[model samples]
Target: MYENTVPFKIHSDYTPTGDQPQAIEGLIEGLNAGMRGQTLLGVTGSGKTFTMANIIEKTQRPTLVIAPNKTLAAQLAAEFKAFFPENAVEFFVSYYDYYQPEAYIASTDTYIEKDCDINDEIDRMRHSATSALLERRDVIVVASVSCIYGLGDPSDYKDLMINLRQGMICSRDAVIRKLIDLQYVRNDFEITRGAFRVKGDTLDIFPPSSEELLTRVTFFGDEIEKITEVHYISGKVMWNRNYAVIFPASHYATTKEKLDRALVTIEEELEERLAELREQGKLIEAYRLEQKTRYDLEMLSETGFVKGIENYSRHLTRRKPGEPPYTLMDFMPDDYLLMIDESHVTVPQIGAMYN
Candidate 1:
């Protein structure tokens, strides 16, 4: 069906008796006009997601739903899942059962280091969400502000993904390189998520973001012989698969070349800002900036990461200041349709959602 002319099918037994009809009509009209952003000023219990689903069906475009909290995200995910049983409905949120972010109380001079335990279920859902988005076009991801947070760039993910076939020329070194690029560490001594170990011709991979499903790669003279999934805890083979792809381990898996280029730009900015500070006689701020940037650069050089790393995202992406950061939305194809549930809330949320 042509997307614009596709009918919005409301599956509910109860019809839009009151104001919902007007709200749905307006949203559909705006979407037909190719509006990039819109909102729905809906009240509580107003079937907001239902209306959004109807709009999505009308357009037949992939959609993303952002919720303010995890509970709301879960609710939205469940609802979308029910509404689109045949389509991909996903959830993306923080993969933490508990988290106390690293912080330092300057006034109290107390440091609160990082503390948290991973939530395996949420981690699985996140992996499922990304996999669904990449594999299918009819996906709807309900997420929290976490969607705006940092993650492995989708391009690296696409690159690192391992493509296997029944009979194809494959190199073990090449496969390992892709894994390492995806942030998996070569650990012959210990096996863990984001780490891989080799035994003769067999390889085992613990995908970073996956809670279950460890992949075992069997090689036949540099050609992929077989691929299987195993239980991470039991080390028991759960299923044998003919072919599959493992995504990158982290959200920031860029090449060293890109990192070096980004650093050069950062240095240029440092020089410019330092010159400005000197001209203004802001010696204190200048010294502070120099010390802070130097420390950050040192950290990046040693570990390829540093605290407050996102402050340098602009340099890495080569985007100008005030430009938008990449989000899940950027990963979607152009033919996808976006349906905003609450015009009053979703519109403002899109602009204000960024850090």
Candidate 2:
């Protein structure tokens, strides 16, 4: 029966031999025995990834492969892309080419601030990974440490999505507001990802951090009458989505009302911090904090913007202290299959991240 047969066809010239067969068999046996996790202990250049892929083909379950670094993740992603030419093979890594997290050195009394430069290519890959996972049963995501970082709750992310059906009565202004609520900015001048341009009743959206098709939202006077997908590089419409639900362009997707509440909370925190500083005879720090926060509040109030906004993400999320931060993993379904490429290395890192 097809159910008992391997769902994939192996096209490689070489076949599994030596310890590879043994490793694959052991892993499969462990999985069948209700072992939720198994490690493939093999040396470098042992073709461990290949063995993992073979197991996946035999099981025919969707998989995720987590790697150690960007270089390794990229190599694994490329390999999976080649192996599963017909499947949704994706890559996820840090979107920042360089990042320095904010730190406070109380001894020297220094606040090392968070700084980062976004890598568009990596950001696009991250988007591709989540999008592919939601759309298909066969997907492989080779990722780095970025996967464990804080992100928007997937439930909220999915909830914010707006499905635009063909001939649906979607108001132009309503669609624009939805896009904004999803953290997509309206930039009539700049035509970049996560930004939309309005040409009369027509809207063109270059999805934030995506490697897929550019979505076009065209309206007929007030209603979103048609939605089409176009090639980002070629500027060609490939297909029309009977319906399209746009996800938040960024991790921070807060409504205006929410932002107002956040501002209020921030103000309260600022006052509390100021009082603490003053009590400790940190007059300089108190003044510095007051100035910085006042400037930030002004910026937030004026243009609805502030620098290094993610530093306050914990407060913005409104989660209890010590609770785990949300991440891309939350975007995955409950039954989503996961495969760690270098399980011996990856499994440990997964546990280490929580601490």
Q: What pairs collide in candidate 2?
A: 151-326, 194-208
Question: Which candidate number maximizes TM-score?
Answer: 2
Candidate 2, residues 122-205, lDDT tens digits: the string is: 777777676655555666677787698887556555666666777888688888878877767888875778888788877878
Per-residue lDDT of candidate 1, residues 154-226 (tens digit)? 6655665767654557877788877766667888776777788888887888876566778888889978888
Report backbone clashes per prediction.
6, 2
Q: Once superposed on the true structure, which residue ranges of model 1 sit more than 4 Å away at CA?
A: 1-48, 54-58, 94-124, 149-153, 188-191, 274-303, 349-355
In angstroms, how far off is 269's CA in candidate 2? 2.9
Task: Give all candidates' CA lDDT scores.
Answer: 0.72, 0.74
Which pairs of residues collide in model 1?
39-343, 40-342, 40-343, 61-337, 151-251, 152-251
Measured against the true structure, the TM-scores of the candidates, in listed sequence, are 0.75, 0.84
Candidate 2 worst ten-residue window by lDDT: 1-10
lDDT of 1 at 60: 70
